[model samples]
Target: MSWTENIPTWQLVLLSIVGYVYLCRVLRYRRLQQKHALYPYKNREDFAKMTNQHAYEIQKYLFGVEFPFTMQKALEFALFRTYGIPSISSLLVKTKQLSEKQFASKRYADTVVLISEFMAWSPEAERTNAAIARMNYLHSLYQKKNLISNDDMLYTLSLFATEPCRWVNRYEWRQMTEMETCAMGTFWKSIGDAMNISYTPLTSSSLGWRDGLEFYEELHRWSLQYEEKAMLPSLDNKKTADETTALLLYDVPTSFVPTGRAIVSALMDDRLRKAMMYHPPPSYIQTGVETALTLRKLALRYLALPRPHFLRHDIISEKADENGRYHRIEYESEPWYMESNTRNRWGPQAWFKWMGGKPIPGTEGGLYRPQGYLIHEVGPKSQEKMGLREFEEGREVLMKAGRGSCPFSIGK
Candidate 1:
């Protein structure tokens, strides 16, 4: 106070304002710390018991509240990781899902919708059950033909479990705590179990993992080895990657497309770039992108306010419409399951689509299905009426198994 008294009034006022802002910033981080403190990091017994409900809460906090945009990007990149594997890309090509840009876009949207349906809802919710059943029905078609391998399935699941944690730690404001990472493992293990994917490849499969963290660690190790062996450059991988990358950059302005592709390349590791047969991004561009991401992380950590619960980002709509249909809250290239209403067709964003000569909802006369989507019917149009019986059978199995209990306890 004595020193401030010697200073000019303007300087004193400036200092006071700066002090207030500093206090607010400190308190903001404290709130985040306090919220994280809710979980039991020290109690081993209780920690091991943390399963579905615990995972759902923590994931809600992470994905919907804290790092929604970043988490979405990470998961999107996770999907891209699968295309690096020749077998997976070959299968996708054979199915004609990645044959054309439009088909690729539709396939991408369908996957996003299906995954959001389950991940955004309670593990035991009827909607979640329906989503999982629909997925099982679709996979059964390929499984019946022996086109999909179990190790491939396991590897796909591993990326979902590990990639987000890796991405957040690498690029986001903060790294996930062990408890948070454990929750991710617990949640996805439940999903893999639901899909009937074998865990035999994991070293701990014989002994059984004691908790989600253990499962996560074992899966991570196995996935790395699998990638080293399976991810190799191939024509199939390049074609799929090219089309998918095009679909990803469809929204960007034409002039910036090269830069956009470079940014995507910068995100890929050397192995993924090689597998996709992509050249390295310019060294300058790579450095610039990494620098930009680093700045964003620092800004978000110290300056951005904590996202409020009310402002959480949901990937899927919370309630069904009068017709018992749900709408996806977001889409990539095409609006596969979005309701094409006046707002959607004539909104500000719609103007951009119109100017770009891109397809908008309601223009193709139900080709994009202006009508909303039913949960059980989201898939390739040819299979709209096909998987119903298998879907019903799968749904029955989930219900009998207690909707969403710990997946590990299902057959015990």
Candidate 2:
């Protein structure tokens, strides 16, 4: 028999009460500051009502992988750089009752809490603990074999303890950025143009790369005259850029690709390096700040980092594509294109830095470490080389591939 089915009604009630009380205590960041509070469920109905939403969402998450009611708990990979309690027993249980409207189920709710803790309260503690752990480890090694001077060992240990935070910050900052790429598409009168080019296309069109490029370029047209100076002080009287847009989908990717390529390349170029140092485009940094703030809004209570501060492009690296052809979105939780837009930067920005897409890493000797993204020199090859016409015809195609499941699997 199932555990819940076999349990007596009274026993279930008792367990729920105790579990909830423990959860309340856990919510309190510090015991000394305030006493723990109750779950605040006025009645069974209230508890069920709150929990039902999460259950529904969980079902959807599981259903996507064909594991709806019988879902596996998250593995203890400790893959992410956050301080979270291990063990997934609490995450596995599913209440059939809440499946209909589960929005804040225990699993998801707990995840939010953990996210908040990592971003907000846990960083300093984790840093300190890691340092202590390393020292202890090094000391144990020293005990095993006395090889070096105490001062040298001590200094090395100190560096090990403090080094991760910088790396963590770098990663966190980059993930907060969004990216996009545009293609042959059109918006309707409902969005903007009734006779737009985005509508006409069949898989059987456009044979080669040159033909495909020209074909989609027309579909994804941008009259550079207006957007190039929307805020030039002279254009203040002009309409908001979107008022003229038939659709919002194409705007983001088409614009981002070219400019992003140039901005990063100019920053990385040795010839332009001295001139642009510490004075990169205000738009780029502003976008980063905006991205961090947006994430802060959706962030769990634990992810409490201060507003991200931008380091004026002291160094920009141009080691990747100049056309800005990449398009990445981290909308696993988002419902639509707009929602995806909200979390756009977090993944692509990090990927961009990795694959020499933008902002060079460090300078050592005469060589720089290009960001870690795949290059198109070896774009994917398939039996049917896809063309612009096929993509327009609703046939899907991938232009590149790598060893892992997919290059896009950089982050969840």
Candidate 3:
């Protein structure tokens, strides 16, 4: 009491505020860590048996609740990283999706929508099965033509499995625990199996790995070596990279576009920059970007409140409409595949979009298809009317094989 009396009134108030933040917000992840420790994911056999459900829960917490925006950014960067490889870049350029500015936003939205179809739903959900079937059908066309290689496919999968953890550990308020990382590996490996991607290149593929963490580590090493050999500078890489970067920055204010590009470049590693044929941003710009990221991390750690469950990010609408159509809850530059209802067409957010001269869902004609999307219709426009039989067959096959079951227990 004597010490408190000695302190200034303002100082005491400040202390109380800081204490409140520390107690309420700063320890959210700590609480989650304790809760996760009670789960049975620690044992190898138990983890394998519950991989799909456990991984789904953890991912829902990580991507949908705790760090939704951060994980989304990480995933965008993960996809961006794939463009560094010349072979992948060449294929993308040839596809004409990224090459045409008119279709850039649609291409991006299609990707997000398709991935979220499976990701935002339960492992055993019919929508999840249908989405995977559509994806497999599309990839199978290219595979049959030999336009895609197993190594390239594996590298892409590795990035999807590992990059989120890497990004969080480096930039978030807290690093992912081993259990969280292992869950990521387990989930994506199951996806790879469904896509029929091979793992023969992994040293442990023959003898089998002890757990998800072991599998993740091995894949990480292989990805690095593959990048070192394959990610070379080329015109195709630069073209695809530049177009993608432009698409990403399309929403920035015109005056700040250069600064936005610099900020993005600052986040990239030297190898990626070189592969994209991009020069380094000025040292001052780099320093500014780094400082901003550091401050963001600190603010989250010390000041920001924990994201409440009711406000968890919705990657897609939780339920489909009566017509079996779903709309995206979030989008970047364009509202492709979103429903053109009155709320979407003229809501408060729509006014801001109008002021910016950006395309609003209903305002645009059938160009962006404001009618919403079906799970199986998400892909290149050319394939929308095609592949119905193959899609159904793939769906049936995945269902029969118990795609939602424990991945390790599938064949056994």
Per-residue accuracy of model 3 over 1-412 as CA lDDT, tens digit each:
6889999999999999879887866478677766588668766556655566677677777897777877888889988999899888888888877766876677788888878877877667778878889988888888898888999999999998888888888888888987788788777877788788989988878777656677789999999999999999988878877778887887788899888888889989999999988889999999998898889888888878788789988878888788878888666778887778888778887787788899888665667777788878888888888899999998888777665555655542
Q: State the C-alpha lDDT per candidate.
A: 0.83, 0.24, 0.81
Q: Write the per-residue lDDT of candidate 1 for residues 250-310, one digit (tens) a residue.
A: 8899899999999999999999999999989999999999999999887887667677889
TM-score winner between candidates 1 and 2 = 1
User: What is the TM-score (0 to 1) of candidate 2?
Assistant: 0.16
lDDT of 2 by residue, 267-313 (tens): 22232222222224456655665575457433422333222124211
Clashes of 3: 0
lDDT of 2 at 191: 12
Error of 3 at 321 (Å): 1.3
lDDT preference between candidates 1 and 2, better one: 1
2 versus 3: better TM-score goes to: 3
